[model samples]
Target: MNELQHETSPYLLQHANNPIHWKAWNDTSLKAAKNENKLIIVSIGYSACHWCHVMEHESFEDETVARVMNANFISIKVDREERPDVDAVYMKAVQLMTKQGGWPLNVVCLPDGRPVWGGTYFKKDNWMDILGQLQNLYTTEPERMMEYAEKLHQGIQILGIVEKNHSEAKSNPNNIKPLVEKWSKSFDWEFGGYARAPKFMMPNNYLFLQRYGYQTQSKDLLEFVDLTLTRMAYGGLFDTVDGGFSRYSVDMRWHVPHFEKMLYDNGQLISLYSEAYKRTQNPLYKNVIEKTLTFVERELYNSDNAFYSALDADSLNEVGVLEEGAFYVWKKEQLQQLLKEDFEMFAALFNVNDFGYWEHDNYVLIQSQSAETIASQFGLTENELLDKKKNWEQLLFNEREKRPKPRLDDKSLTSWNAIMLKGYVDAYTALGHEHYLTVAKKNAQFITDKQWSTDGFLWHSYKNGKSTITGFLEDYAFVIEAFIALYQATLEESYLHQAKQLIDYCLEHFYDEEKQFFTFTSRDGEQLIAPHFETEDNVIPASNSVMANNLYVLGILFHNGYYEKTALQMLHHMIPNMDYASAYSNWLNLWLNQSDDNKELAVCGKNALENIRKIQAEYLPNIILAGSTKASELPFLQSRFDEQNLLFYICQNKNCLLPNTSLETTVAALKIS
Candidate 1:
């Protein structure tokens, strides 16, 4: 079992029985490496990574490779999700060393932990040869190794540097149009994502685009968004039989997914689809929101209501061997046998023959045409086609459930749980579902009760009723964002108060004064080779960007100038770096709010709750809602309450309009503004 047998992370425990002597990333293992003067081999991967599992079988499980690893180096295994700080530093080093980086990230570092060499997955022979070469170089040419490590360490230090921009470049809505125009050149007009293979569902990018399209009334951009959302939901990336999304599609058309279903992806995608549904009233988007939530609750949700990390891409096949996408993909004969008379229509609808064909005689269900298009060919209405799809889904789902399920990475992460919490809130807001709000509150309560600390801090990972790792900035950022959303949804003052308290903690511990940006790790947490300020918005939006957005919202709600200035300052710092629209999508979204004159809608009176519901039903991205059924202590809602009649005060930049009793008129003012 080596040293990882006692670790709580599922990824670490997966390696407990490996032939290689492995240790979890910690002070004890690191100190032992220094004591023995051995080179450190840091291998980072998550449990759901299919390539990580393949590498484990090909190299780490081999006796000869393990002997070499055991003899020349102290091997440290890191689950990237659990220890993102470690992964960030090493990943930066690898990307600098080579031109690319990926999972099962292997790096050889000097005893003091400066990375010297690294790569992604390798075959057993290549892995052994690389280790042998590194060991030989260390013994025979020590100075050369030291020089390389020093250079790499310096590069790592500069990777995430955010210099404050003193220029008074206006956070203009005009600037976004040119940037989107430049970014639009790369869009795959046919496939709905960027013109590239291995497409990711970058929710923030579309989120920003959705807002910009509606605000600017750009039909082209809005149509692009609709195309992208519809294609993604129709593609194999979305599990038709099950209900959630896989991590990403391996092809340009979103035809075949890499197959791992991650909590962060599903959570963010939910918020995206829900907002789209609100804007367009697309039945497809609503179906995606409901189905994905069902998947999360059924498969990933804990008894405590917090979500687990992910579902493994690889599961046991019929012959009892680990194969990627085994549980999700189906055989043509099996489908024909199961459906019988209905097989012909089902095959036509889902493209089961040539277009959906994957390797090994397996077919990944993919739709090239919409249900409306397919229904026309089959001489049926769209509703009829959808009804048939539902029945087919039920039958296929039951059969698939009989197969071995993919392994679950059962550890609950605070940042991801918060993301899912916001998903539920957005779902409830868009759909007006009371049960969604109830589930969101339950998860919010779970986070405060279990993951949060009385010392104005949070824990990063929780499992088996224990949380030992200090929370990173990502945890605090997403929780604050989610709490603020929850406050808007339920008008619960406690949630708002808790959000303010979290931001206070972040300001003290995670904020960097000189950079005017938040650090990825708290000041009191463990420091790595270099500090990282995650700025780029990937599948999950960057922590600093989310924090900046939260500051902007809370500042308006609580009337704090410092928070407002800090949010703008952070945005100004990012202006020079906004070369790629998708990467800086969250930052751009914040800029959108500022440029559009974001309003504070305060609903206070006898029908405040009822008015709040009507307001939420509209797709108004440029509003911070605050309400009270009667009187309230919040400065934004203070003295504006009257028990006699409903009132809506639309305020911008601390200036308020006269209280209007008409909900319809208020909504019209928001739309026109």
Candidate 2:
């Protein structure tokens, strides 16, 4: 056992035996830097990050490198997954300084914890050069170094102020409509995804398009979303043999994937596809959702019902070690040998030509072909072809399972739990699957029961039965959003009440009253010199945006104008950062939809509740529902609302259109948009 054995973070545990004196991010290390007048070096990365692993092996484990690092600086290691607050602050600094940033984030700061200089993944040979340069600059030109630090600090402060002001402005629906239109115009028509070389899933963009299409009844919006999703489903970015999507495509056609699979990414994408299926009634979309869920269950889901964080892109194969996509590719001969008589038909359906589809090697994902085409080609009935395909898929899935699986990072993160919870909720509603709801409730309970702190705050993550890191804004915001969704799905008052509590905690602890935006960390917590307010969205939605949505829903549910006003204020503050919102279209859409003309559907009493649950089982997004049912009793009525002789009031914009308890009338009211 090593000294870091006491740490709960998977990343820290991975480095437990390293010769480097790596301290977890804490006040102790920062204070030590101040007391010793030594530079503080903060290295940030998550467990599944490939470069982080490489740097750990190449430098952290080297006794000579560790000796130098320990002697010269107070080294602190942070798992970005565990402490996103710290990562966000310094990642911004690194980006500002270098115009780029990534893990392993290597930063050197002054005794006061103001970053002076930073660069990521210094080679062992280059480390001596970089270290020598920094040390010389620090010792011989202390004044110059301090001046540079002060300038960086001031720059960050100014950026913070500007971001804070921008996040407070409420965007007009009209302005957002044009913004959405502008982004849609830039979408790649020939290819399926957004116009870019390296393409991401961009589930947010698809979600916005879906909502906008439904809201405006725009054919183009609907077509755009459908095309993008269909293309992604058939692209190599999605696993055809197994379920789940890779991180992103490295090429334009979505043929070559970067190959890392993240739980949060899959969770969000599954919800997106499931919603798409609900809207379009497309069997392909539904199939994609089911397969993705299977992938999660097979690989990421722990025995405890918690989902793991991610799977590494790299893997070891018979041909030795390889980069991402190694395990996914296959030669045509290999498939021919495996499938025998079915080889040619299968190859044709999967676009496996002699020349190959991706990098001259077949990466099998459904490219183009309806079941009708397959049936016609095989001279069989559609049902027969479907059965054969199912059996063939099973065979392929079994073979793939024999290969070495990607490394799983089994650290459970609260933000990711919130994501998966939403996925499970969506799956349950869309498919009417009891197991999905069971998993959702179990995971939600795990988070609240296990990760909740004695201080009445939520911790960010848990690993091996221990929760350690402090929760950031995203943890509070996203989890509350999940609870709200769960409340709507189950019509459980407890989830709503719990969500309200989280919202209150965030407002009290994280809200920057002066700045008019939420801080990433609480004011009373271990102080980083510059507390950041994240307005821009990343892979997950921004904390500010999620919180803004939470406030909006809570305001409507509780009829608290203060919460509503706060939500609007947050939108207003964020409007100036509209450029940033381009990448975060889903959140912007949610905010814009609320700002336009928000509707609340309140289902009261047993009869109305039964009808409402039936409508809710359809998986309608953006509708907020409040019920009077007790938390414990809510899960029993998981099925759609039963038609009964109970009075139900359908309220939109606080106006109740004639109360009718019948299922038909309730369904009619819900269908009114």
Candidate 3:
């Protein structure tokens, strides 16, 4: 086995026995690079990355390629999930240098850890050629090579400064309105999604639009979110045959997908859709949530109740061919053979054709016909047709299970769990599903018990009973957000207390007093070139933005003036970046629409608790709920509150009104705003 066998990350362990001598990304490896005066080759990827695995097999596992890498460079392996801060830093560099970046990120850096050149994957022979060229340049043109390194290092420094300096102009409220208008104008009205060819499941944007619609009562905004959610629910981006959403659509219509499923994306989007359902009372939204939860339970859930990261996009088919959509796609002949007399009906319903939906004659599972059309065509009632479709779905799921499943990235990450915890908690409230609450509580407990350190710090990821990577700001921020949500759902004091403790730790360790924003890592943690403060939205919301929203909500719930002040300060700090809100809409949303009236509904005492739960079961977006009770008594309200509550106060603007101990008064108070 290679030295990577000793590493904790499953991604690294996957390469344990490869011919490559892979060293974990650490000071030891960096020091070795410096000592040997060798160029450092850093390859960054996560476990469920299909291309990462392919690259590993093609290059890292090949003896000749390994020899070339070993002879020419000091190789270091990084699991992007384990060290997102590092990944973010280098990914920015790669994107700036090459105009694009992705995993398996292959970069060649100088001994001092400054990246000089990089790209994603390269063929074995091509890689050898590049290695020879780089080596020759370093040997013969040392000064030119040093100059190139200096330029790259300076470029990175400039990017850091730019990132640090981004903030919306707070001098004029008019500044943000234009940006909001710009985003609104960019909405794809006909399609119900954003204007783009390759569409992403951008829950953040949809969520922002939902909030915008509530604030402005714009029919366009509401329609955009509603149409997008419904279309996505009926499209290939959503696994109509299984459950849960794929990562993104490869086409403009959301009809074709890249096929990878990520837990964080599913978790966040499920909550968004559930909240939309609550607002619209749309059965389609509810159905989407149900199917998504089924996917999570069947595929992503681990034994510990913590969710896995993702499922690979690629799976081997029956013929042993590595096909992208093989598991999901169906051919005309195959459907006819399987369904017999029902084949035509099912084919028409699912859009199955001889030509198929994808390249290479593959077919993606889709809902081409409306429920009414399918019912009429099949000569059955809507309920009967739905039941038949459900039965067929089960058949497909069972059959797919028998085939090669996509490789699971089983590593448990604190940030991801925090995101999913909120998802489960929100879904529990929206659907009144007890099982969702159970999973959320178990995962929260797992994180608090296993990932928390004695020093009040949190680790990022865990695998095989070992947790090693130091937690980043996202881990602390998102987990705290999760705890706060769990507290709201269950009205348990402990979760709130724990969340407050985490907030304190973040303030002490990660907060930049001068900058008024949280740093990506603690000041005393491992030294990078600069302490990053991420404000842009990616697949998940930024740590800074999520934590800012978290703090704002906590302030409202607890009536803590200081927390609200801190939140405002953080938003104020990020105000200048609003010009680019289209790209960072998730972060910008927290600051764009100011809520002048935040109603707080506080239900205290035993009699009011049941009513409070009933109120919570209904979607209340702008209100915060808190119950003052012992943690032990939380279990009785677990089905209602779902195990995290006490000292309940639901308010806005940090000025909670008098606590209402009656359900009627609580409802009346909540309805006021």
Candidate 4:
């Protein structure tokens, strides 16, 4: 029986009708394996993964392969997104056995669910051959299978292993710069991003580079940062017509991307671009930031105000054949017909020539030249070209909408949605836009009402009016981080109070006193083969790393040295791998922040909200803003309320300068003193 029909995961639903008899991961499935004395074949993948879809079509759909699987093994289909804990254990096992790991991960494990052999995305012939061999070896040579499982299980458990760092222990702030310069050699200065074929838009690397370049006044570094951002915005990685970035570019030039847009990627990119815009006031960054948010609101957002996880990579084309990038790619004839008068200029502006070609005479709509430059070539003023361009984009966008839409994974995750929530908050802070703030507060309210429990716990995922799975450290850490951002955005004390409660809950449940770091699962959740502590940065910053940053920021908010020390210790354990710090850029950023001169921009009076809005218009990453319309006792807000004038003051480390009765003098004072 296919138990996947009972599962809530979209990835599982995508396979619910497979020829194989599939069971969703549960005690019943594992128990069936043990009771029947059959090997367990655990296949894990996410809904939007392109290769996962390919494998499903090739192997899982074949009746012959289904017979082999159903006869010899108790087959379980696990959605990596919904059951990441299970995926993590098996993925680690696969990576240990084979040097690489990705989804459509197939792991052949013991009846007890201890992984013995694993690999990803095999063809029908290859799948049958491997399955037959594994089944034979398991039954005929039980001792060999047991040996492999025992050792591989131990290896997977120890992979996230943390170690002490002498560089961090020495407490020298100067040590990080040389390593940053060394690691930067890999950057693709001309094309943007780290030099590679499949370029992921790892937002942390650019965030670190931009901040480090600005703080150190390194002109070359700053130029590299700007070049990267500009090129990426112009590239196919960014959706020019619609909005939101794809997963990554398949080519080194960022010309053609893997069209699926993950919520986490767009959310982090929005936050990154928001900060970049604040620092440089670049129109390109602001444009991309706003457009991406528009895409989120239009597509990824659920009617209930919660964000969805992703959009599938494959969709039906005009002829209804399922194809990758079908929704995004365009034939030249389609564009030429739509923009008959403006076709020549549009083609030139977007590089619809052979240079922009992807596959089958289609272009991904990547911008090769800016409108200003293209306007000159077309014998038109910039404004005239811009007017034509805007009109053309809307027409093309509307036309594209009439085509088949990609499948949306409607599962809402606490961690991913929280990241998007922080993105909106950052967008509001950078742009001083009320709409972004409204969106952020709306999402926050929805999470509090839906995913969160009245008893102060969180659920991991929600879909179709049902929330399932226990919340992991990531859910707690990111929500805690988002709540802090919310408090800073609104200064609503309830937000702070909620953040504190979440953090306390994390400390009580996720923290390991011996390791001094968080395990990925809560103490209350079912333990995996081994408890995992994710501390490295990948596509997402490690949950533990994000938690440490929350502790550091919360320490500043509450003047708690103990919290600060714990955050410092977490960094200390990671700082020895200086070259790897590029991947750990979030941790390094937190470390650098420890020495940053803290600024408190306090606005107190009946008109404090207006003053806060004005003060926040500036890009002050190192400052904490406190506002009160009346008297308050909060540490950051103590005695800040004024009865007479709209008083403003600048304070540093508990020493405040003379209070100003006007916002003008206060803004000027912050300029130099």
Candidate 5:
């Protein structure tokens, strides 16, 4: 075992027994690199990454490769989930050098830690050759490597340059339509995602599109969102037998998933499907939400009610080799033997023949036909088909459990847990599930008790009853957002107050005054090669974008003019940099809030809580909610609380429509229904 044996990250622990002497990223390892004048190999990947495991087996375990790495370099293993700051700086370097980047990110840095060379996964021979060449280059002429490292470090520093746009004209609903038009050219109208292979379920993209489509009354865009959501849910990207989504599909059709399930993806997806359900009342979306939450609960939910990070993509197959998708994929013979008389119907519903066939006679269950279509073809009722489907799932789930399950990355993260908590809040609001609300509150309380500190800040990661790692901006952003959602759901002033406190902490620690944007790492945290402004929306929305949107929401909820102005200023700085709408979907969502139709749904009266619940159930994308059952000092609810009757006021920028007692009439006035 190496120094990594002492690490808490599962990814670092996976490398603990490697022949290579791997050390976790810390002051000791870094100081050793500079003291010895040895090159630093900073390889970053999460535990669930299949290619990361592959590289570990093919190269790090080999004695010859280990000798070279151990002698020439000080190796540091980083779980990207745990140290995103490290990953961000090095990833930017790799992207600058190669114009692209992915997991199993391997970078060779100078002794002081400026990256000299970097790439993603490489073959053993290539990896060894590159290491040898780089070592020889440094040994022969150290100045050459230093020069390149300095130049690359400079490039990395300016990667996410955000210049403040001093335009007085704010981004409105119509101003962004042309940006969507530019983005629409890449949309795979037939496949439901972008026109590309390896489709990621970018939940926030669809989220923004759904809201924009509905608000603009664009039938084409709305229909496109419906098609994308339905196709994604039906595809093999979604676990038909289980309940959650894999990370991304290897194909555009969403027919072949990469097979790792991430907490962040599933969490955002729940919010997407839940909101879509409210708008369209699609039963399929509800099923996806319920099933996905079930998957989360069964696999990732911790004893403390917070969620774990992820499940690994690879698991031991029948042959005892680690294989991707082994636990989920099934052979035709296995399905035939299990289903018997129901086999034909099942095959038709989830394409089991040629369409579903993968390598090695395995079939990944992907629905090509809708349940209604399959039921009509089979001369069966919807209820009968639903029963058959449930039975088939039960049989398959039981059988699959007998196989070696995927390894769990059991460490919990503050940002991801908060995202999942928000998911539960959305599920409860949309479906009126008491259990969902109960679970959300429990998790929220757990975060407060365990992850939060008495000094008015949060810890980033928690495991084994210990919280470590100072909170990053992502942690504060998502938790504040989740707490606001909780306040909206229950109208608990304490949750709102908690969010306000966190927001103030972020302003003090994470905000960059000159850039007018938040940094990814807090000032209190360790400084990396360069500070990153995470602005792009990938699988998870960018931390800065989430923070900006949170600021906008809280500004309205609390009626704070200064907060609102700061949010707009941040948005102004980001507008010029939004080259891709999908990449900046969260930012665009904030832009949507600036539209004239946006409302502050303020309720204060005897039945305030009841009315807030009803208002949230409707698909009101432009509404920010706040209320109190009793008299409150919040500007939105001040002097408006009536003890005798429930009153709902639809206000915009402190101007109000006459308070109405009828929920239906008030909701209809917003033109939501």
Candidate 6:
């Protein structure tokens, strides 16, 4: 066993008992490598990565492979979650060298921590051959390794630059339409998701198009949006047996999946689908939102009402061999036995035939048709079909429970929890369901009580009653977003005030004055070999874009000139690269809203909170509501609340129309603007 046994990351602890001595990334490990004159082998992966486990069991566990690793290098294992800054630099190096990258990232570095060469997953023989050759080359030609390391170091320093500032800024909504239309045409209209195999459900991309569709009243954009979400909902990528989505679909048709479910993907998906449901009122979107939320509550949530990170992709099969889809795939005989009378109906509706069959004749269920159509063809009512499906699903779920379960990674990350919290808030706001609000409030309280410090700062990770690691810019950015969302949902001033304090903290510490964007790590945190200013969107939206969004909201709430100026500067920085707008769609969306006529609805007096709800049920993305029961909460509502009467005030740019008690009157006035 090595030092990883004492660490908190599940990824590191998984290798605690390996034959090769492994060390967590720290100053001591780097110092030891330099002192011993050994090269450093840095292998980074996460807990839920399937190939990471494959590498561990295949190469790291072999005694001879361990000997080769131990004698020639100082091996280090890093969980990308605990130290993303380190991961970011090395991943960039690998991408620059090879033009592609994924998890199980293996890099050979010098003692000073500059990566020279790297590649992703390798077979055991290829891995051993490469290690032997690396050691031989290092000893025979030391100068060659040093030269490559220096070159890679220089390249890493210049990666991912969003412009410090831009010239000739303008808010033209027309510029975005062509780019979005071109990207939308790439969709796999017959199936779901974008064209090609290995499809990822990028929720923000859909959300941007969705909001644009609603704003422009474009039938084509709306139809594309509906088609993508509908196909995904019916595809095998969604766990038809369960209620959550896997990480991504491995096929364009969404018939096969890589089956690891992550909290971040599900969280963003909930928000995206809820907003779509609110705009279109499609029952398909509503069913997805509610079922996904149910899955989260059942499997991912902890006792503290916070969320865990993910579920593993692999589980043990009936023969005691480790397999990838053991927990999910079903045999044809098992279905027939379980759903005796309804076997044909269930099998036909869910495509349990050869079309859905995978390796060894096991099936991954993918929807073949809508329930209404199937019911009509089968000479039954829709209600009868629904009841039959639900009953058969419950039976399958019960039988599936008898199999070995997949591993669950229980680390509670502040940034991911914040995303899920935002998901709950969006669901509540869109659906006006009391339980969703209650859940959102509970998670918000959990973060405030546990992850936040007394000085109003934040922590990155919390597990087993302890929260450690200084907060990165992402933790603060996402949590601030959640706070702003809560304030909108409940009209609670404390949430708004707390969000302001967090933004001020970012301004003081995370901001780079010369770069004009926030760094991924705080100035006070332990420095990495290379600092990163992340401004592009990936699986999650970039921190810079999220911060820009927070600044925009705060600017409107308090009428702060500084906040508006900074937000506009960030938006201008994005203008030069509008051609790559799909990756930066979240940041580009700020301008989409700016291109429209926005309004602020300020409600006051005794029934102000009640009055706010009348507007809440409607789809009003352009409307901002601020309410005060008495006075002094909002600056504009200082004396607007009278002693006896309730009123609605429509205001924009410090101009108020009139205060009246009629909801329709306020709606009519808002429409005219």
* Collision pairs in model 6: none
Report the alpha-carbon TM-score of model 2 versus the true structure: 0.90
Q: Across residues 139-164, which tens digit of lDDT does each residue of candidate 6 receive?
A: 99989999988888888888887655
Which parts of model 5 have CA positions greater than 4 angstroms off?
none
C-alpha RMSD of each candidate structure in angstroms: 1.1, 3.8, 4.1, 2.0, 1.0, 1.9
Give me the overall lDDT of model 4: 0.85
Candidate 6 regions exceeding 4 Å error are 653-656, 665-673
Q: lDDT (0-100) at residue 331 of candidate 1?
A: 95
> Best candidate per lDDT, number?
1
lDDT of 3 by residue, 199-220 (tens): 8877887787676666556777
* Cα lDDT listed for each candidate: 0.91, 0.76, 0.76, 0.85, 0.91, 0.84
lDDT of 5 by residue, 217-305 (tens): 88989999999999999969999788899999998889999999999999999999999999989989999999999999999997987
Candidate ranking (lDDT, best to worst): 1, 5, 4, 6, 3, 2
Writing each residue's lDDT as its tens digit, candidate 4 over 302-367 gives 877899999998999879988999999889998889999889999998889887999888898877
- TM per model? 0.99, 0.90, 0.91, 0.96, 0.99, 0.96
Model 5 lDDT at residue 99: 100
lDDT score of residue 533 within candidate 1: 89
C-alpha positional error of residue 399 in candidate 2 after TM-score superposition, expressed in Å: 1.8
Candidate 3 TM-score, C-alpha based: 0.91
What is the C-alpha RMSD, rounded to one decimal, of candidate 5?
A: 1.0
Instruction: After the best TM-score superposition of candidate 2, give how far the Cα of residue 403 lies from its true spot, in angstroms.
Output: 2.3
Least well predicted 10-residue stretch by lDDT in candidate 5: 164-173
